[model samples]
Target: MAAALSLLLWAGAPAAAQRIVLPTGEYMDTTSLRNPGCGAPFYQYYQVKGKYPVASATLARQAQAFLQQRNGRYTGTGLITFRFGIDCEGKRLPWTKVLQTDAAYRPTHFAPALVEALYAYLQTLTDWRRASGPNREPANYLTLLSFRIQDGKVVAVTP
Candidate 1:
């Protein structure tokens, strides 16, 4: 069997940051995976709006493809990571919450590529919005994507 590794990342406060590692750099986070269910991700049901029809699995595949094309070693055996926050510019931003993965995966090196692809896809979804639960007051927010292992280890992240 192919060994795997995954990681997650938080945007600010290096002190608050954490990291997870996996072998072959292609590992899965067994937990926190949103299943490809009867409908789109819960976010889609709410403020997130778009005419372009796509599924969660397709989104995952797209992210994996983007990773592979960038020479990333992910073999698709991992849970995803996420983040929801605005930049210094205060633009509504939803992204893959990046994890420190491994020594080779550094913010200065691979972060931009991964984030760029994710943002590009997100931009395609119009009026992207999110709410914590159905029937509750909807909060205008950006959603961040992330993944984690049962033991709290990060699998893969996009920031």
Candidate 2:
């Protein structure tokens, strides 16, 4: 859907850096994404700490509402997991990775339209809580969101 991709472009993902490698060996060109030159994304379950409560939990709630607002589109019983990073300056990078699986836990493809819609919504979140080093330096870390769908509806969102 060109329209969907066009909307994704406005989400600020530039075509130069934003790359989408579909299983069909095709990629979407997004030409204006803000390059979050913060740094490499690192994940350490034990190392990441919050001097404050992580606000990503709030984002999870918002995503649930988003699904409800567009109820008829996302159809299927499965799980969609997204892994991404929030840069040092609290900007989300474009290296988002999505994994989908059916209710039986087998790898599968959820509706592409649904995936794109949700991905677009994630790009709109501006309330990311930046993690900082003990000395108060901006830090880059990875985060995840898993949406559970059942009977063509998003039933749960997990962090």
lDDT of each: 0.35, 0.61
Runs in model 2 with CA error above 4 Å? 1-11, 14-41, 50-61, 134-136
lDDT of 2 by residue, 50-114 (tens): 22243445655677677677664567999877666556766665555677889998878877777
In candidate 2, how many Å is residue 145 off? 0.8
TM-score of each: 0.32, 0.67
lDDT, candidate 1, equals 0.35
Model 1 residue 42 distance off true place after TM-score fit, in angstroms = 17
